[model samples]
Target chain A: DVKDCIIAYFRRSLQQGGGALSGKRALVTAGPTHEPMDPVRYIANRSSGQQGYAIANALADLGAEVTLISGPTTLRKPAGVAVQDCETALEMQALVAAMPVQDVAVCTAAVADWRPAQIVGQKIKKQSRDDVPAPLELVPNPDILADISAPSPSRPQLVIGFAAETENVEAHARAKRLRKGCDWIVANDVGENSDVMGGRENQITLITEQASEQWPRLDKNDVAQRLAALISERLSGKIDL
Target chain B: DVKDCIIAYFRRSLQQGGGALSGKRALVTAGPTHEPMDPVRYIANRSSGQQGYAIANALADLGAEVTLISGPTTLRKPAGVAVQDCETALEMQALVAAMPVQDVAVCTAAVADWRPAQIVGQKIKKQSRDDVPAPLELVPNPDILADISAPSPSRPQLVIGFAAETENVEAHARAKRLRKGCDWIVANDVGENSDVMGGRENQITLITEQASEQWPRLDKNDVAQRLAALISERLSGKIDL
Candidate 1:
């Protein structure tokens, strides 16, 4: 159902003049990075990657050469886009570091912040009632957004990060934009509106250095289109990044 | 694709004399129980629920009055079966406990052995580089198999548990069978066979008190059909429990 809906919107956008982002290269990350605890177990999030896929499709429809780095998800590849698959956060970081320079970068993937310190070579046995199980030791994952946003001659013209916050959505996002050094942060409160988390609808606030504009809840495709429009304008020097 | 194959197998089996399991009530658990760390994040396994679904369909085709207690999965409800949805190991345990007396029980869900001791009310904020992350405190989840296997007046005549072993498949499963007091343990070596974990084929060993039968690798549907037939014979007093 989600795939059909995404395809329908993608087709509609392709029919319209989508030359706004022509000649611009874009990199997008979609889905949740599964941090492996062991061979059979992982720490993961509920992100369905629907929003990320929609964004990639929207950008592709707008004529940008897009490469989508995706985590493990059930969704099929978006039409007219190149896709690279990775599972854990560290693997995703390596792929991102190796990508060619782009005009725009959108970090929508909900990368896990921590991973097991060591992957147990074997499946951990379920202990008897008397035995106490071990606690999960974790280490911080590579900061992909910060790495991509650092000052460098090869840095993309515009870098966007997404924040799924439970409280103080705007304040947290505003701080994250500064903290991560990204040009903009798309913030959404998944605390109460779980419909926006893995579901089809999304309500987001576009946070830039100068402005924080909350958009009405809309279909994920519409949100992608609007974000693509802003990205095109920013790249064309019609608007600030 | 998996659904079509399963449905086709179910139909072919239905055309055969499937009355062997008639008038018998069966309970089955399927999928991976997601143990939530927060609203958006969870500890999950790479279970696809395909094998479990196939088993449910096969049992139903054999004229068993089946109730499938399943964890979170993307699969649609199987035809001709009653389904119950659950998210965590504790929830699945509760559902199993509440089911009406069953003639046979199949525990195939890949339930997490431990859950976060305390579920964070808010999403855990991604700390700065200087901050050390806290270890994930975990506590053992309820042993659903042991509980269901405990001697009781209403205990099912036949109880089957599944073990996904990376090493010592037969030995671990034999020990598990005795430790959990289940009648049979279906053990599969997932070490060299990752495809069996989530894909559509399985090679398993059925360990019972009397003998161990090593079944050849086959399509998951066919495995289910064979296991269902074994269950029918056991319930009909032709085979040992």
Candidate 2:
């Protein structure tokens, strides 16, 4: 019954000349990537993958062929979307790199910036109580978004990145857009009491080359829907670029 | 229908006189605490609350009155268990400290050891590109397990703590038991490929004063059931202390 309802909803939209993203292909990366410390331990961020999954579902609902590349999360697969599960940052990078050119690419993953330089074959054991903490060498991971946004024949028409900031949300987001050479950046404050990391609701600022638009707090799904609508407008040339 | 089934199952267990934990009261702590960085950011760990929630559900099935104190997690509340949500380690400690003595207490929370000493009232702002990374001053949080395990008139009969170790699982667990003054410690390897932090399955070593028992990798719920059974046996005087 639910499946039929969803089909009917989409059919009605498709009949109106075109669904928002009909025939468009989208690549969405969500969740937090784990950087292996050894065979048994990893460094990870607290990203529940709710926002990214919601975005994938929203894009799918608008008739986009969505490929969701996700990190470790307990969420069920979004219906009608192709899913790819990944663990470490390297795995995510490899998967994204291998994907075909897309109309749009949204990088929402909280990718770990650093990973252990050497992954120990065995578990790194704890030493005597008096001994110092084990030394771990870390190296910067590849910047997936930057690579995807690079000037290449296969670059997506539009590349969007996310910046989860603790302070100076707008300024930092603007800086990140320039630094990464991405077309747009969705910035949000994940400060204390914001409940944005793993909570249901989010407030975001959409930073474009021309301007930054702020949206009030809303449920993650609603945010995704609104973002999808904006993406549709941008792709359809309904709004000034 | 689900509630009715659960009630029926528990009722049947109660009629058997020694339902694994009949008349027992349990306290469970789960998930990762968020220590504030500023108005919008926090320092937190990756704890899904799956293990603790599973343990709470398992104990409830055995006719124990379970109270789950959880941090931020997307998990649904376990059926028939009273839940208290908390954000920081301090809040969790307060809740546990104020409770009436529990028959058994399980500390599965990955509590943040330190919190920002001065929580900025507004969102922290990023400085110039040449500026250094923000320096965060941290202060130690109260150790809930140690406080609960202290020699108090209302101390729980059994106090169990968890040691999520990357290496030397047994030795660290053994040391933890003595340092925290807890009766038992559940030690687990969370190394590179283990996927233990947010994964569904876990392998643990249960360490007591006299002996240590290693359990094969099992689903979190199965591990909880096994642990509950062990607790039941110990309380019934079937297993030596």
Candidate 3:
């Protein structure tokens, strides 16, 4: 009788405040993918994966089954989360496509828009001084967020993407949200001297179909916590999505 | 009498195994320097700065006054070492040029060989599907290691550079050592399947005028310690330069 009572109490606790997202499933992508130019060299972005890692940790803390698909970063994996490491944009796209159904999807990785059309099998040697510099042809990579946000039976109910911009942050973010068919877009300015790409703190604008809210600069962890709380409230039917 | 006794003790200790590089000054460059494509985005490599940071710490342990010029990284600064943060290749070049005379210089940074000839003042928006992809003109960046290795009044006595290659590692490293006029070159392979660029462990080959020695794969920290010991031995006149 005592064991049964304890089991019932714990089951009920799972649906309450602290564990509001206990049964939910979430997928988050973070870090910068490396696109190869040659066997030795690659093209990459400057994303540090701090924001994405923090969000994954926050979701896990709320009892959500979180799968963090990340590129290379020095951060240790969260205790209760599953991690899938990838190197290129294509690899990340494939992994995301193969995942099970998710209630929430956060696409934060700075996927390279273009990759070398052809990768040299060996090291690209330096030419003589008189020769002209080599030309690198590029091709567009698959757009993961847009593909996932498309109307499909397996599409997540809520999809979030990030817009790293330098000018007209709100306008670009809103436009991206409409184009990609994502529910929300987190916009941040990473101009030449903004110090936001690999920095500890960030200032973001949360743009949705109804409103655009500017948030004060805060540590990446705090941002993740706030976002997690909002997601919990919305998923619990306390706030309109 | 007490002060004299203490001075004599420390002088004797300096000649032993540890602290063999006492009173030496070192300058190290690490991480990938960003080259702007537009105000919003940049061109970067996959270097994580782990190797360079480890080398800096190892050198500092040997009682060398170290100055580390680094690009964006999430790692904390090593204790007792001075760090100068930089964003773009130009910024890094200027800072390295202005540093005081050093006895040893290690160029571990994967500096972008080319930067955008002209940076767009505003954000570069995506155009319609029919529009051609944007063209990013390129210009070569200043060769920091070669400049430092040139025979000059302020040149470091022992200059080292890194050659990240995928094939013909020894040949390329030797050629680079000769062309850059550097005393030593540390070569490593970052092939498509090597998983070495941003990974924790590394395999390196130390190339000098006398010989090329291949080292077994090891953790990045251990590699740094071994390299530091070799540097100390060479600088202390225990090994030929």
Candidate 4:
């Protein structure tokens, strides 16, 4: 629904002489990484690739070449977009590392923070309550967003990261930009009623160095298109288009 | 994927400890509003109720009776959650108004910035290119996040908003928290490679009045679970839950 709404707005704006986001290349990642705790258990999320898929579709609509790197998802593929499939954060990093630098990169995938130290050749059996909780050692995963945005050989012109927070959402998201060293951040409160993950609409504020532009709530597709259009504007010397 | 991750994390945490989020109520909004131009055309976005739905499911796993006020979404409803569906910002406002005060409220829906001054009853033809550039009448929509979070009779105990920034992401998001009048704000860069919309992973910092916490990239579900756990901690002994 968000995607359809965004497409609607995009079509309308383009019809109204809005900037065309043509001749740009973008890379996006979506869904949650499944870090295995044996074959039976793994660490993953509930993401359905709705946002990333929508963005890829929107970017393509703007005449940009879009490549979507996704974890597992159930959503249908958008028309005329390339999709790269991955699982773990490490795998995502490998894929991103392999890609040539592009005009923009959107990291929407929810990579697992910690993975089991060992895949565990066999699934551990359940024991009595007296037995302590099964402990699978965790090791920190690579920071995919930071790594790509870092001073490196494949640094994209524009690198973005998602900051999903609860308390102190903005502060945390902003800090993440600096810490992760990304160009922009899309911070949303995942506290209660966020339509971000698998829903069709979303409410967000666009933060930049000079000002914060808080848009009224709209569909995620619209948000993506507006953002893409803005990206087009930035590339085309348009101010706040 | 975010919802599943949150639920998995919550179930694990619940098994590990008692009295975590035992009696809290959370309200959230997601997706885009439909600002009608006509029956054929309406304003909306690319949001896919992933984050909001995940948050609610996570909160429920932590023993909270969650009331999710979602906009349009394509994903199946999360188990054991009370869901309210809405289309416009005004509809969401009415729903939030009808509910009892919640312990925490996170407004993540992207409400439309403006709606057509009037929804034309019939679809207009594609007039000449000269007429194509004609500007459509516009009107400002309600600020639902601010309206509910403001110090009013129905304000929730904790309120949070989202900021999606391109440049100066954190600075802008922080300012938005003040401007929008919410207890906390989550800001992140949605620039290149940052999938804040429909992607699965997120990394954010938690900015509070006294301190900040930078979390590594994690699944949106993990993000939700962590937030629910943290919210429960912060609201401990303060609310009935």
Model 4 chain B worst lDDT run, 10 consecutive residues: B125-134
Q: Per-residue CA lDDT of candidate 2, range B1-241, in tens?
A: 6985777566446635567788888899999897765554465666788999999888888878789999988798886678999998989988887788799999998876566677676654434323333444556678788888999889998999998887777988899899889999999888666899889999999999998999999999999999988887887789866
For model 4, state the Cα shift of residue B66 in Å. Answer: 0.6
Q: Which candidate ranks first by lDDT, i.e. highest?
A: 1
Superposed model 1: Cα runs more than 4 Å off: A1-18, B1-18
Residue-level lDDT of model 4, residues B19-51, one tens digit each, is 466666778777656665543335454456677
lDDT of 3 by residue, B25-141 (tens): 889999988877666457677688889988987887777878999987767777667899998789999999889999999999988777777878876666532233555566777
Report lDDT (CA) for all predictions. Answer: 0.88, 0.82, 0.83, 0.69
Candidate 3: which stretches are off by over 4 Å?
A1-18, A128-132, A191-195, A200-202, A215-222, A236-238, B1-19, B74-76, B128-132, B192-204, B215-241
Native contact recovery (fnat) for each candidate is: 0.69, 0.08, 0.31, 0.00
Q: Label model 3 with its docking quality class.
A: acceptable
Name the better of 2 and 4 by DockQ: 2
Candidate with better lDDT, 2 vs 4:
2
Candidate 4 TM-score versus the reference: 0.48
User: How far in Å is the alpha carbon of B59 misplaced in model 1?
Assistant: 0.3
Report the Cα lDDT for residue B148, model 1: 85
Could you give candidate 4's per-residue lDDT for residues A1-241 as a string of tens digits? Answer: 6875676565445433533755567898888787765533354544566777778777777777678898867777665567788877889889988887788898878776556677764433222212333333556678788788888766877787876654566776667777778878877655445655567876676665555666777888888887777777776677632
Sort the predicted structures by TM-score, highest score first.
Answer: 1, 3, 2, 4
Whichever of 3 and 4 has more lDDT, that candidate is 3
Winner by TM-score between candidate 3 and candidate 1: 1
lDDT of 3 by residue, A35-73 (tens): 876654576777889899999878876778789999867
